[model samples]
Target: MSLSRLVQRLRHAALCAAVGLMAAVPAAHAQSDADAGAFPAKPLRFIVPYPPGGPLDLMARALGEKVRASLGQPVIIENRAGAGGNIGADVAAKAAPDGYTLVMGAVATHAINPWLYASLPYDPIKDFAPITLVAAVPNVLVMNKEFAQANGIASVADLIAYGKRHPGRLNYGSGGNGSAGHLAGELLKARAGLDALHVPYQGAAPAQLALLSGQSDFMFDNLAAAAPLIRDGKVQALAVTTLARSSLLADVPTIDESGVPGFDLGTWFGVFATGGTPEPVVQKLNQAYVQALRQPDIVDRLRVMGSQAQPLSAQDFARMVAAEKEKYREIVKLSGASIN
Candidate 1:
């Protein structure tokens, strides 16, 4: 063959090989799209940082039902409560990044624990991928009605003033050290300039019991846990810890406006998957949660529990976590709260 003809044939072969490779690329891309579209083909396990019968557990179960219905797969709730919520959070953070395991993370586990614990098993900000901020539950300052009346505590402002005048004489109960209730009380103490001692319990129910029995002067509890008692006149709600008045407790003023300026703390729950989950999967989970939050039944249940349905995008949730981390770092410093 002529040299020019030989060269032409060789170039044509190379061109044909390149064309074949290019044709296979779309087939691979299509397979990936197919896999991403068929997410949650199996059951999903959602880990709650608290045990059953608590606010976080209740919220998880409620939301999990909707997620199951929406995804057409079973969404199971796994409780791994301990270490001020660090144990369960660490489990979720270290879970497989395949979107099968998620965690219902709370303010304590996600925002405060990092600053409170000297050596966390997982990085709060980096170890897990944030899916969405599912809901927000305002913390209520409740005192046993009879106890409050006996102590002549009628209003939140009065309680703070009295506690200041009689420093170290008053003590408040919390779910546990560095829990949301604990941080809320600490924020109150720091803002009100009061010397009230803290009494941490295993959970809010116990804390409420302590307040009822007059073992503690007052208790900071999730509105869900305190609302029924407050309504039945068992406990007198002095104020809510949110910056704005909660619709569930419109009559109760916010602590920020009640005497302690800039006092804002509330327990929040969100969903997160392990880091390295595919972006498409994260988007799918976020959309599912947003839909679940809008369901009428879920909305009613959350509202009755004194929690509001709030949803945010994955990026927005990440930014929210970062902001909370910064805020709580300052709070942990001011409150001198450390797990180690």
Candidate 2:
């Protein structure tokens, strides 16, 4: 062959090889996308970082049922309770990014606890891929009926004024140091300028029991847990910890309006998979949750529990988590709350 022709043929062969390699890349990527789209081909494990019957656990079960129906797979609930929900969250964070394992992440695990603890086993923001924010539940300020009646505290203003006059004589209970209830109480103290003592319990149930038994003067409780008690007259609803009044307790005023202006704290629950999960799988989960939230029966059920569905895209949810982390960092600084 002529030298020029030989060189041209070699160059053409190299060009063809490069084109073939580039073509194969997309084919592989497309196959991967197809596999991700066919996700949950088997059973899915939904991890709840708390014991059964709690708000997180109950919400997980409810959502799991709907997810199972939508995906045509069994959504199993696995309770791995401990370390203020860090244990199970760590498990989920380190899990395989196959979309089969999911965690029902709460504000404690996703936002608050990360800053509260001196060292966490997993990175709250980077360790997991956010699916969607399923729901938000506000905290209600409640006092034991007997305690309120005895102290003549009929309203939130009355309670605040009384706390100021008594200074430290009043105490409020919460699930634990970094819990939403505890943070709500601290926010109230800072905004309302009241000097009430903080009493921490192992969980919300014990905290509510302490309030009911008059062991604590007041408590900031999840509306789901405290609403029924307030309706039963076992506790007095002072106010809710949100910017606006809750529809479930329309008669009750918000802490911002009641006395503490600009005071708002609430808890949210969402689903998350391990980091590096495919975008298509995350989109699928978000779509399923958004659809579930739109169901009339699901809406009514969540409303009765003093919660409302809130669905967000993966990017939006990630931004929400970052904002929450910064917000709580300021809160922790102001409140001087540290787990270590």
Candidate 3:
């Protein structure tokens, strides 16, 4: 064939190939849109970064049961407890962004741990998409009954007076160095201008035991866990750590009201997915969980456990997380809590 004719034929073939590729792009986008429309075709894995029987684990199960019916798929709860909830959070953070995998992230996992740990596997703010803030349980300031009686400590003022009179005489116990309870104690010491020793235990249960055995002077404990003891007169409830008094212990005063103004801290958890999950999927998940939280049964159950179901929009929850992260940075430094 002539050279000019051959060149023309090659150009025509190349143009046809380009046209075919252009046509395929729209088809690919349509497939993607279809897949998104049919989200959650399989079981959803909800990771609770704590062991069984804990508040986070129980809440995860409750939410899973509720969301399953709405989403038309099983919401399986997985307990991936370790490293102050970092393990499970990392798992969800690294999961595919299709929104099938979720995590029940807590103050420890997302807010406190980011500041407490020297190095972390996941970026608390950047690694996950916030769905909604689920609930918050207050921590109560309790004293051993005998100790309180001996020290003449009836109110937060009395306790502060006693601590001032005998600096370094008051020692408190907590779950560990960087746990919420520990930070609470440190924050109290700083705000109240009191000197005290901190005793770290293996877990909250052990720390509560120490308090009961009179091995430690006082500690900040979860209201639900401390309720039975308070009811049985095992410990004296001084004040609640949150700004508002708990309905379960309506008689108890808040730390802010007691003496320290603007004092507010609690154990809160929320739902999160991989950072890049589609906005529509995140909204679907948020709506389902928020609906679950609003149920009368769920609200009543959480209230009995000294918690309140707080369902915020995804954007609002993200703002809360960022504020909490910054707040805890100061607290962690004040406590000098760190892990390598």
- Each candidate's TM vs. the true structure? 0.86, 0.86, 0.89
Worst 10 residues of 3 by lDDT: 1-10
**Strongest candidate by lDDT:** 3
lDDT of 2 by residue, 1-340 (tens): 2112222354466467768789587776677568677687899999999889877787788888888899899999999998889999999999999888899998789778878889899998889999887777778999988989988998889998899889769999998887788888887888878889999998888999999899999999889778888888899998987776788999999887886767767777889999888887887877777787778877887888786676666666776776777778777777677886
| Highest TM-score scorer | 3
- The collision pairs in model 3 are none
Ranking by TM-score: 3, 2, 1
Candidate 1, lDDT over the whole model? 0.81
What C-alpha lDDT does candidate 2 achieve relative to the native structure?
Answer: 0.82
Off by over 4 Å in 2: 1-37
The digit string of per-residue lDDT tens for model 3 on 48-75 reads 9889988778888998999999899999
What local distance difference test score does each model get?
0.81, 0.82, 0.88
lDDT ranking from best candidate downward: 3, 2, 1
- Candidate 1 structure quality by residue, lDDT tens digits, 1-340: 2112222354466467758799686776676567688898899999988779876788789889899998899999999988878899989888899999999987778778888999989888888899988776778998867768977887888897788778778888987877777777787777777678998897777988999888988888888778888888888899998777888899999887887776777777789999888887887898889899999998888888787677777776786777777778877877777878
lDDT score, residue 241, model 3?
88
